[model samples]
Target: MTVSAWWFLLVGAIVTYGWRAAGVALSGRIDPNSALMRWVACVAYALLAGLIARLIVAPQGALGDTALWMRLSSAGVALLVYFIFRRSIVLGVTAGALWLMAVTTLAGG
Candidate 1:
């Protein structure tokens, strides 16, 4: 809405795209099967798992207000839907969100 905000957005876009462009430039030379790549992949998965665990176990804000069992149940439903839909992330997340809302409202949380 302001000049400063526009400048900030422009800078953010430039920085984000700069790294992406560099990655694209270097991608041809990087070996997907290399040990370094494997390590990176493992680290990424570990970080994701840790974040998910934290959100479920000790969430902040609105989610924190919900009961632990509700959170766990939603996560279970999400996982089940994920597998049932052949690992479709969109469907899994949608089902989980819908389930969480329904349960929370029904239980008067």
Candidate 2:
């Protein structure tokens, strides 16, 4: 990469780390169980959910090559497996990945 690219990366890293450090410094002063904190948590979760839904509905790159139904089906199965396994993250992820691979292969992708 060019020197400019390296410079940008360094600046970006510093900025990101600065924000993280600031957050850490302020963490003790903030009320973790405050209403504002609860609202922020809810908003963060909603944003994450929206992003995941958008990706499943209109994926990009390799994921986009797979059919929407296949992705949805895999996600559904993963959720089911997660619940059935008492929310084991490992099993849930494995089930989702395996389902996606099997569906994609069987579909002749």
Q: Per-model C-alpha lDDT, please?
A: 0.92, 0.91
Alpha-carbon deviation at 83 in model 1, angstroms = 4.6
Whole-model lDDT for model 1 versus the true structure?
A: 0.92
Alpha-carbon RMSD of each model: 4.6, 3.5
- After superposition, the stretches of candidate 1 with alpha carbons farther than 4 Å from their true spots are 1-19, 81-92
**Clash pairs of candidate 1?**
none
lDDT of 1 at 65: 93
Residue 82, model 2: lDDT of 97
Worst 10 residues of 1 by lDDT: 1-10
| Model 1 C-alpha lDDT per residue in residues 8-94, reported as the tens digit of each score | 989999998997897899898988789987998899899999998999989999989999999999999999999999999999999
**Top of the candidates by lDDT:** 1
Worst 10 residues of 2 by lDDT: 1-10
Candidate whose TM-score is highest: 2
